[model samples]
Target chain A: MQRAKAEFDATGVQILAISTDNLNGPLAMAARDGLEFPILFTALDPSIPQAYGVFNLFGDGLASASVFLIDKQGEIAWKSIGKNYTHQVFPEEIIEQVKKLN
Target chain B: MGAVFGRKNRVLIAISFVAALLLLTVACGDNLSGPSLTSGQQVGAAPSAEAEQPSSAPTPGAATPAAVAAVGSESKSNTPPATATGAESKPDASAAQATGADSKSDTPPPPIATAVSKSDTSSAVAATETATPTGTPVPAPAAVSETPAPTSLPVLVNTPGPVAMLAPDFTLPSIQGPEYTLSEYRGKQPVLVVFYRAYW
Candidate 1:
């Protein structure tokens, strides 16, 4: 997603990644990848992913890979839940979904 | 009468011992082979079950034990799952960069890789299992843009209204030390919320 930062910025979409990992893991990741966006961790309460319906979707005791495009009104405009835990929606596909919103 | 009772007791004891031994063997066998088989089955069944989740009215309290278990195991297991190797390369590099960027001596990369690699292998497998194993990592599929979004809208979770449903409000802390409320972004700018199974 770091690769598409410029494109996402061009579209006025704010990218927020919720990491199921502990705080340090994503903190280390963002720092290492020079991630321009915020990578939030649910250390305070791990239910955030469950709220999103991404948690334990794979039953591997982990969140399933998923994406939600929330419009300015906070309603989900489009979403792609991975066919499997490993099936991630690519950044370009995300950009395409965002374009559809406009 | 005493002799008959003794014989019956001996027969019963022998039968019970045999049954116990059989159960022991079965239990041991299951322990030896169950993980891989169960994991495979769960992988196949998960998608079908997950597809139905969005239609139900989700309660924030209906969290699963698996999610809690994942978090509990997060700090304990340092060894990466066996499946991690095929897909650990990219994240391992990023982890190395993380190690350097944070200048912390304690953070080991393997655990993070291990937790994430189990599922990530699916994508890698999806990519290379049918196609050639290129040195390149996951490429942004720009060409795929014209195609009906590469991922299916298999699940429409957390939506209730005829149109779009308001995302459940959340006040999560970013790694950068600020609280982000999902509803706060309402009327501000479109937010793309990506829930990554494991990222580090």
Candidate 2:
């Protein structure tokens, strides 16, 4: 994420990272990892993850890692849902999906 | 002294055997919980999909992709083979179930907004065949309009274009500053939303 932020920004794509952790943990993580893109937390309100159909997906009372590419018209252009705790979409796959968009 | 040492050795062996039994019991317990837990994940999408299967089969325009994505992702940990196979057969119904499930969060199925490109319409037609045989051809229009026509239902959305599922709108506080609303970026820029399971 740190490496691809500038490239994503160049393409006018905003990267928003939402975590299942509470407010403070993600805040500290952003500071620790030097995450420049916006880091949003869903601990206070979990409706966001639930909306995306990923809340408690792994049965650990937490969200499975996932990614959604929302087009300019607010429609989901591409999405990859994590099947387990370790699953995640890579930066290259994300770039590829972004390129597919108009 | 020799007699006493022999007795102590027997006691040590007994203790080790008891410890081994306890470890095996815990391992077996986890094995038992594993299927139930994984099946719980399947239940989230399957039951709902199964419930709406009959009604949602005809309208595969906008919902096909989402259903395909859901089934693809969950295929690996498919604990219940029955639901997985059933979901695979008719993903369009699962798409409606997905919309219904997420409706509480205000994430409606994507409204087919504009004319689908020739290639897209062709592909959507191919996809529609998996859901229904008598798929209606989507009417590709030339005129561009800013306001999306209120084509919400599958019965009424036959002519508009291919369906695109919309992301649910959300507003949440960020580490950077004040809250961010997802819909605010619509029509301005595309957004990449990432959900992470923070280790901390």
lDDT of 1 by residue, B35-145 (tens): 322222333333332343223314221111222222223223212221221242333333233333422221233323333232233222222222333312322221122
lDDT of 2 by residue, B1-200 (tens): 11222333334432332232222222222323333322234335343443443355665433333332233322322222224223334433333343234222112112221112222333234334436554434212211211132233334434443467788999888878879889999999999999887642
DockQ of model 1, rounded to 2 decimals: 0.32
The lDDT, on a scale of 0 to 1, for candidate 2 is 0.54
> How well does each candidate reproduce the native contacts, as fnat?
0.89, 0.89
Per-candidate local distance difference test: 0.50, 0.54
Q: List the residue pairs that clash in candidate 1.
A: none
Best-matching candidate per DockQ: 2
CA lDDT, candidate 2, residue B125: 46
Segments of candidate 1 deviating more than 4 angstroms: B1-161
